[model samples]
Target chain A: MGLKEFCFKKSLWVFHLSAGSCNNCDIEILDLLTPRYDIERFGMKLVGSIRHADVLLVTGIVTNKTKSRVLEIYSQASKPVLVIAIGACPCTGGIFTSSYNFAGPLDKVIPVDAYIPGCPPKPEAMLAGVVKLLKSKNRE
Target chain B: MGKKTIVPIGPYHPLLEEPEFFKLYCDGEKVVDMEWETGYNHRGIEKICESKTFEQVFYVVERICGICSTSHPFAYANAVESIPGVEIPVRAKLIRSIVGELERVHSHLLWVGLAGHFLGYNTVFMWAWKYREPILDMFEIITGNRNSYAMFTIGGVRRDISEENADKLLKVLMDAKKKISLLTGAVMDDPVIHARLKGVAVLTAKDIHDFGAIGPTARASGVDIDIRRDDPYAAYEMVDWKVITAKEGDIFAKAEVRLMEMFESISIIKQCLELLKKENKGDIKVKVKEIPPGIGIGRAEAPRGEVFHFVKSDGSNSPVRHKIRAPSYNCITTFRRSCIGGTISDAAIATAAVDPCYCCTERMTQVYDIKTGKKMMNAAELIKLSQKKTEEIRAKGDKND
Candidate 1:
């Protein structure tokens, strides 16, 4: 692997973008930092700034209000950023698909490298999804 | 007068986990006024509930606030059931209380952890969350999902808590109670925590009454209002427990009320478990034929506060109209009263002290003036201001020693 790819695999700084979620997925994302799941063990940390993020972790269904913000954030992030959609909402709009404000099945809005599907995906499932995403990226 | 500066937090900020915007109108370091803009997380849940059948509405409401997922369903069920004049079985009521109380325990712990994190105390955040896992595990054992339990149904509950599961949950709750007590003692005795949080963001009972705030926020200010006790829904009336209240309506009092409420939640759960043992199993749900055309309102005490659900039915499977009023709707608004005159540093915790759930309350966005929008301060700077204040307090405390 190239030095850049090696570094990316070793430490993934993820920026969590809540695109209009019920806060379930967001809590699960926070759960990763807690002692039980502790994603930091894998050298993955949730960063505050999108510009510093290697992976843009998007949660919730994209509403009309958050759509432009999501687009702007995605564009602002440095290139080679992997976009992962967490929860059923972003992946396929979940139950809120028919809502008046519904504006996404996120892949249509922007590129998604991985989709972690659940009403709110379990922390274990999220960890596995990220690990698999990294392994796939290593292959490329 | 100091120059006015507008500090904007969210739509996408580190401090807020949800997508809502806040405009802090500051005169130098002190916040003179505040404005909030929501609608980013609005999924049109009430409108969507109209399209789904009564059975399906439960799941939709479950996602309204993932932290208090069961509370929405609890209130929705109460509303829908009242429309049909259907009374759920005793066993179901006990199970409902168990689920609701367990949610309260976890949700309050979540707020405590986040409050600690807001104050730059990561140790309290980690400790609070670590103890919260057992409650989540109990939820998984009872309702299948850790976050959205989906246990509530129109007339009863979807799942029955078995004898073995109740025993396991009881064991976990006992252990959790012990650990939480230890954590609570540490927080209550910590000089640094007291220095940072005590007397910060003080709100009065009149302020809570004016804002119509409920739950711990109102209770912290000595406003004796809890829907669970007032309206007495589910097993809240069935069990023996008292509402936790504090006279001082400040950030520290809010934390104290939430932490102590966890103990009450544990007690309620334990009592419900004992009650569940006496009740017969598999008598959880009742089959309802059709709803008579009528309007019914239901209210439940969520972790943060009261959750109200209004259902209008027309003798059909689906409700014609559904309106939900989450606690954060009223609780968050009180930021106007609590935050003003407080330093920009204290404003962060003051806003968060309500445990505002944006998904439950989002309805509109802020209108930005093009001229002044470019000079907005972000959430990171606000957090730094908060941490800097905490450090100053710590240094002051050290000097006093």
Candidate 2:
């Protein structure tokens, strides 16, 4: 196996990017770390810096102010980064799609490796999305 | 301006859930002053609400914050209900209080967890969040979702508290209360928590009034102003719970008020459930055939503070203009009082003490030396600085022991 694959096949560190979310998904991501779900068992953890990440979990519908920043961060990530869009807002601008500043459905702005769908996807759904993406399994 | 380093806290950060910016000007270890700004998460929600019908506005308002999902819609519903010749069913009113109080219990626990995490007390964070899960589970059981419970509608609630589920809710609440009290007792008795939080970032009543602050931020200062008790909306007037307040406006006092209020919320929900059981069979909504032209103002006490919504209708299906004043609009300014004259280490926790819910605190904030204009610190490093200080203090205490 390649060095990159060897390094990330077992452990995944994610950097969270909120283009412009309502914070439901953001808190849910934190919930994934809390004891109830304990996603740490899966060897997936949220890191503060994008440079240390193998996966980029993006939340929220992209507002105009955040769109450029989202693009910048996505570009800065190392190649072989998996971008998973969390929540309906980031997936298709959700309810705020009609709003003037709403510039999202994340894939429109940047390539997405996975999409976890929900107003705010449950922590389980988010975990499943990540696992699926790692295997290059499903697309929805 | 002689020689101050800017400890920038945002634009984006994993540590800070909200995506906003705070430029803390520091003279040595002390924060001399600071400037805060937000707008990164502004989706023009109020502007968008104008296009949707009055009936559809609740779903839109529900997205304001995942933590306080019911607050905005609750306020908006009251605004719509306030339109002349509108009256909701009695059962609906009780349901509103049940949901509101449940929200308080969950939010306070969430804050407690985050506060503990910031203070480097990982165990406390873990314990608090573990207790918080049952509350979310109850929400999921009752409303079919955990975060944003879309129970509120213009005329009344969309769902009814069935006789069977009411008993289930009460059972879940008791389990939550037991766990929460255990957490609260642990938090209250902890000496390290007392040292770190007591008298840290004291915002006096005068400072509170000057900043127009509300909710726990104000109540912690002994400012007895709760929209629930004062305005008497929904089933608040019918309930027997008293507002929890403290004389000192420090972080500890804020923590105390929030912890104490969780019990009050539990009590309120219990009372509402009992009342619902007694007078259980009633309409959950009053069908408003049409909305007449006029302006209506409504306020609901969110977990953060008073959520105010003003709706202007012009004899149409959709509102002409809908104005919302989130509690953060008032409470966020209070940071001017809290952050100034404090150590840079105390800065993050101090700002978080008010629970500003700043939407713009969303991205990776680039910190600079300000003078050299070169990147000096990332968000994690700054948060680490705060956690490190707490650890040092704890280590010294251990040495003294």
Candidate 3:
């Protein structure tokens, strides 16, 4: 396949990583894949292995204990990867921000591309972010 | 003892959103030994109780887990109210029942979606979640917050459903019923789903007794135990609903039990809404009074299963000791028995099908890259990076054009 054809035709495989979140954010992320938003229409698919993914959708605040696991997944992805932070907690630490257990914001660790803000953002917003990211990537 | 390969699922596993960990020792593909470690997501909520008043603690407890947020406050309020002998208005009880069942409907549907994702059935996952939006919209209309509906007070609910809201709820309920039927039909009839789930993780009725399981896990295994039916609380006694049970303790049976329970929840919500219109409102919340110095236990059927809250009050403004027990805790205990002969992938779906909420069970932990010796991206940074890349690609496209 030609370079441009390969880049455009190959769908973006997204891997979801939960640092620590109430299931609210996780469910909303899952909802993006559902028929209402159908993230797949934009060629966004949830991948089981980080090795195959182009986008890493991380939810929840990254605490001290889960630090290694989250970093491990980000390192596993191939180059030119995009990351989407999915909730208030991960974006700005939400309600659990100042707690002694937590480490800090998600950006403190890896490069972030989009922030879908909500106590937990709605599924539509999540899909919008995914499509926006893919469209931008294809344009490049 | 022979050497066993150990795999740790969660603290950052896909089966659950929360951060609990399960270390399973496998013999080839079969899980031979399983033990769970919690405390990753625990914010020391009980510790927070020491600084807040009884009224404020009500709000704090509600933040325990978003899915069961209302139930935590409801159970705590029940414990605090009984201490003062404060009589809750009948209408208020009906309203609480309505809110509780609505929560159950959304939570179970959410679980159904997660189960579908775990089983490699993305269509069902998407369909179930799309259907759940309406139920959550109903919650937003009534209580404001979609996830943690702060609806309860010490003696009763904070908000009352007007006739207008009730009518809207009825319509929503009708839509939910139709959508749920389509979703459940897809789950039951799909050969792919049946192959992945049916008879994959078997838990016998006897296993339920041995593990001291409660809620859907127990019900699916023929252990006829429902806290609502056996120990009637709030308006559950007045509502006409049946405790659904399944003879087969496999993942499919568990799925069936959860799907059928949605209908029962809808039925209970209908009865409560109807009762609400006929009854006159006297008081939505009783006056805050010091709870008598004694320990009390409050149990309610949360969406996942029975959530038991034990409070020890020393006639003080706050509880002396509070122990919160989520039904998933009991259900996770049964995983050893269930995953013994299953493949690694089967274990993932089966554990997820149990609807484990690790946030309540464990504290949050940070995950890093084991191979690269670098930090992992959190949700916000990932979103930003995704956006930036998209923007850069779009700019290049415009220039080319």
Candidate 4:
């Protein structure tokens, strides 16, 4: 199969990483797949394993303990993968940024393609970020 | 017989991100045994509360979890208020009930969305959340901030819901009632959802009581203990609403209980709004002096379940120790035992149904040898790819310069 056709056809399978978020972002990520947004209709499915995913959507500030897992998940994704940091927490460390426990923003560990900003970014904005990332072909 | 394989489900799993480790002994499709490790998100919130004054500590305690932020402060405030033996203004009491129940409305709607997604019912997830936005807008109008509404203060709340906001709230509540009616019937009647969730992850009533399970978990298992009723606070004493409970102790039952509870929340909101209209104007929050030095225990029914906040004040600027016990903490205790015999696919549903909050749950260190662990490629290759990206970014920056 031609490379373009293959990438387009497979569509990006998202693996949501909770770098130490407030579960609000994680819940919104789940909301995108629900009937309203119906992300699956756009050919994007939330995958369980990073091995099978094409994009990594991370939420929350990267803490000392969770940094390794974030790096590990990023490593597991096959090459030409995109990482979308969702929520204000991951983008700028949000409220928890002041805590001594937090390591820093998610970009400190791996490359981030886009930032979806909100304490917990609304489900629509999250979906919009994914669509923008996919069309740009910037990850590869 | 084939050897049973042990699969470690987290501490850093995508399906379940709450910093919990679930070791499952599985023989192909069937899980034989399970073990779960927790305490990953432990931030010593209680320890931090030790030095703050009662007033400053109130705000700090609320930061424990956004989903249950209101409940924590309300409970802590109540505990301290009770110590002073202060009689909160009648209006303040009713407003507290209204705000607490309103928080429940948004929280339950949020949980409904999560429960739907966990079972792969994306349609229900979206429908529930779409309806939830209006309720949050109502929250925003009343308390300014939607998620962390600092409405509750010691002895009373910070502000009152003006008559105009009350009218808007009544209209919004009416809309929410219609949407919730449609959703409850849809969730209860959906075949795919029922097949996946019914009778899955059963926790018996006896088991619930023994494990110190609170809120919806205990109620789902038929344990009739809602702090709103047992120990009335705010205007819950004046309002009339029934505590919703179910006997199933499974995911399906919990969803059903939450859906039905939304109706009760609507009932309380209507009552409170009516009271606001009748009362017109009164003191929203009473002025208070410094809280005496002592330890206080505040308990309330958060949307998820019972939220307990233990605060210690040294008569200082911040709390000396503020321990927060989120409902899922009690629920997670049951995971290791309940997950036995379930499949890897079922693990997500089982875990997510408890509404486990990973951001609040602490994490433990996970060390894996790079070369031997499950890897699509080696560390060197990934590092090289990262270095290449860095070089490209530098080149782009130089070009711009």
Candidate with best DockQ: 1
> lDDT of model 3 at residue B41?
63
Report the TM-score of chain B alone for all candidates: 0.90, 0.89, 0.87, 0.85
Candidate 2 chain B minimal-lDDT segment of 10 residues: B359-368
Model 2 CAPRI rating: medium
User: For candidate 2, what TM-score does chain B get against the true chain B?
Assistant: 0.89
Local error of candidate 1 at residue B234 (angstroms): 1.4
Kindly list the per-residue Cα lDDT of model 3 for residues A71-134, writing each as its tens digit: 8878887866788899887798876765666778889988888888886687767777766866
User: What are the candidates' individual DockQ scores?
Assistant: 0.74, 0.54, 0.38, 0.26
Q: Distance from true position, residue B121, model 4, in Å? A: 2.7
Local accuracy of candidate 2 as per-residue lDDT tens digits, B305-331: 999889999999999988888887888
Deviation (Å) of A89 in candidate 4 = 3.2
Q: Candidate 4: which stretches are off by over 4 Å?
A: A1-13, A32-45, A49-55, A78-84, A112-118, A121-140, B11-14, B17-19, B47-60, B190-198, B341-347, B361-401
Predicted candidate 3 versus true structure: per-residue lDDT over B1-401, tens digit per residue: 56789998765554556667788888888788787777656565676665677777777677667777777777777766766667788877888888888988888888888787776776776778888888888888998877777788877788878889999999999989999998888889989887888888899988888888888888898889898898888999987889999998999999999999999999999888888777855566666656888877888888777887778888878888877777777877788788877888787877776777776665233445669946776878868988999999999999999
Worst 10 residues of 3 chain B by lDDT: B361-370
* Docking quality tier of model 1: medium
Best by TM-score: 1
**Deviation (Å) of A18 in candidate 3:** 1.8
In candidate 4 chain B, where is summed lDDT lowest over 10 consecutive residues?
B359-368
lDDT of 1 by residue, A22-138 (tens): 999999999989999998987889888999889999999998878999999999999889999999999999999999889969999999999999988999999999889888889
Encode model 4's per-residue lDDT on A43-67: one tens digit a residue: 7887778888878888767877677
- Candidate topping lDDT: 1
**A3-119: candidate 2 lDDT, tens digit per residue:** 656656787898888778888999899998899999888888889888889889888888887888888898888877888999998888888889878875799999987889998
TM-score of each: 0.92, 0.91, 0.82, 0.81
